[model samples]
Target: MSELLHLGALVPAAVGVGTLLAMRRDAGRADVLAAVLMLVGMTDAMTLSFVPPVVWFAALIAAGLALAAGRRFSPVATARPGTMVSTHLALGVISTAALILLMPAMPSSTPALVAPSHEHGAGSTMPQLVGAGLALSTVALAVVALRAERSWVHRLHHTTMAASTVAMCAIVAI
Candidate 1:
């Protein structure tokens, strides 16, 4: 489970960094897909069983930064095709990339989630079903994101992100 959390964290860092640094010029649909997945993965870190409160607070701060960058991203985000690439998108991608890289490397990291005294957290056997649901949602989003292109890609990513948000919400019930 610790390894899964580490891998989960790693996946976003790779995708977000790749989206910003490597794919900035081309703006491929895959790059957009990667960014979206990274964003979700970052938020999903909060759902892990063993993460501590301070780390959770750090995650909130990071989410605020991402939202700020998302706001900055509106220009390029709304620019007419053939006019310009999105500056806002670039900002969002880069800022989030920085965050994803910084988070897991911190000192005094969150404690490993202990097995719940009652029934709670990712350690709960029942919540694995919820994890399955969350996984399914991400998979669906990935499918839609990878399959779509251009304007449709953006739309699909939004829808997928929305679905991912809801599925993630279900995690709290665990």
Candidate 2:
């Protein structure tokens, strides 16, 4: 499960890098935001102590990028308002959730919040809630995009992203 989780974390990073490559000549707010997300995912996939700081930095940058993208592709100005808003918002949500997941576990002597045994570790409930929230947000974004977008490419991308987010969320929860 841990190995699968690590693999799942790479999916977004790969997609983000691919999108950045595709926009080589004409990169925009979306591309830049995707790059930030890629960095976040890549850092999170690692099991190093330094990962926490890197993920925090990436999450901060991604959050800023999400704001910029949201402004650049405002719903009123963009033809695919749903897609534009949902995509950036989803990125922001996932990034924030990643930050929460990296939070340190409390001491073993502490009482368990939801488990009878101390096996699960501390700060578990918050991460699980955040993971579930991320999954739901991603799924909702995909649905909104599927309903609003006319392009097959975009539809496929949204579906793929939603699936990846679901798996990543499940991994985080576990």
Candidate 3:
């Protein structure tokens, strides 16, 4: 059931990416890059065992910083004042990184409770805190996305991707 929940979180992300790519011609470079980054972060979250946690942490941080900096420094993001897709995507990536870093080492398929207790230390609560933070950030992004004057497709993509991150965060906190 836990595995199903984890995999289920990926569905919205995949759909969002597909939708964004399908309408890439209409999207700004930042929007397209953000969507791709969100998808990559989600994929890494689900496949954490394939690489070391530290590697995932470093990669995600770099990706998040790059996304944020790219948006801030890019002429496109500066020219467009209303759209916050890149901001949303950067937060999602960073949130995923925090989730990954806080999570105790365990096989991705194992339920959190099923993992050996020793794997969970006094810091086990950190993931829950991070999850809560991510949830709040997701909600804020949702509001921004809804209010943005972008196309419906872009708004939908942002919403779905944000939802996917929240779902993954919730699952990890479980």
Candidate 4:
């Protein structure tokens, strides 16, 4: 389960990195779609971590619905490319943050947050890994985007993807 979770995030990692390499000022809609799909795969990992599967599923459903509703209510009357990209990035980051904050607090981890079922030793190393991934992605993207000549919307994409990539990595790695 651990290995699968790690592998699953590989897609978003690749997409995030690849978008940067593409020099598009920001990623396209497909990137956002792909990243969220990768996030959904964490359902299995959540079960392995002994968290409630139904809750996670419901959360994912809520997120998907929210995204859809936002799209439906857009001023453009249809989802614009920029809106899609930003929405994906926002959802990805929010979901990742949720996972990171909730994991160690689980009933299974109570009284022994790091040692219960964490084969990786539930040590300080887990949070460190998560923090590093999140920090790197967001910081790099922010620096790159602000100095960029693109429009403000492009800047939003840059910040969103950067923050979300790091957040997702942080979440899944834990």
Model 3 earns a TM-score of 0.77
For each candidate, what TM-score against the reference? Answer: 0.38, 0.61, 0.77, 0.35
- lDDT tens digits, residue span 24-132, model 1: 3335443355455445545544344244334444554455455445535543343345421233333333333333323332223444542222334656554445444
User: Candidate 4 lDDT (Cα, whole model)?
Assistant: 0.47
Name the regions of candidate 2 deviating beyond 4 angstroms.
20-30, 44-49, 53-58, 61-86, 89-100, 103-124
Better of 3 and 4 by TM-score: 3
lDDT of 4 by residue, 92-150 (tens): 54445444443443333334323333435556575566556556756664665457535
Q: What does candidate 2's lDDT look like per residue over 4-112, in tens digits? A: 6656655664664454344333334554565555455444433443334344545655665665556566533333333443444446445544643443332232333
> Tens-digit lDDT track for model 3 on 91-145?
7777777776665454653444232334557666866887888888887877777
Q: What's the lDDT for all of these models? A: 0.41, 0.53, 0.67, 0.47
Model 3 bad stretches (over 4 Å)? 23-38, 77-80, 104-118, 121-124
Report the candidate with higher lDDT, 3 versus 4. 3
TM-score of 1: 0.38
Using TM-score as the yardstick, the better of models 1 and 2 is 2
Q: In model 4, where do residues sit more than 4 Å from their true spots? A: 1-29, 38-116, 119-126, 165-174
Overall local distance difference test of candidate 2: 0.53
- Kindly give the number of clashing pairs for every candidate: 3, 0, 0, 0
- Candidate 1 structure lDDT: 0.41
2 or 4, greater by lDDT: 2
Clashing residue pairs, backbone N/CA/C < 3 A, model 4:
none
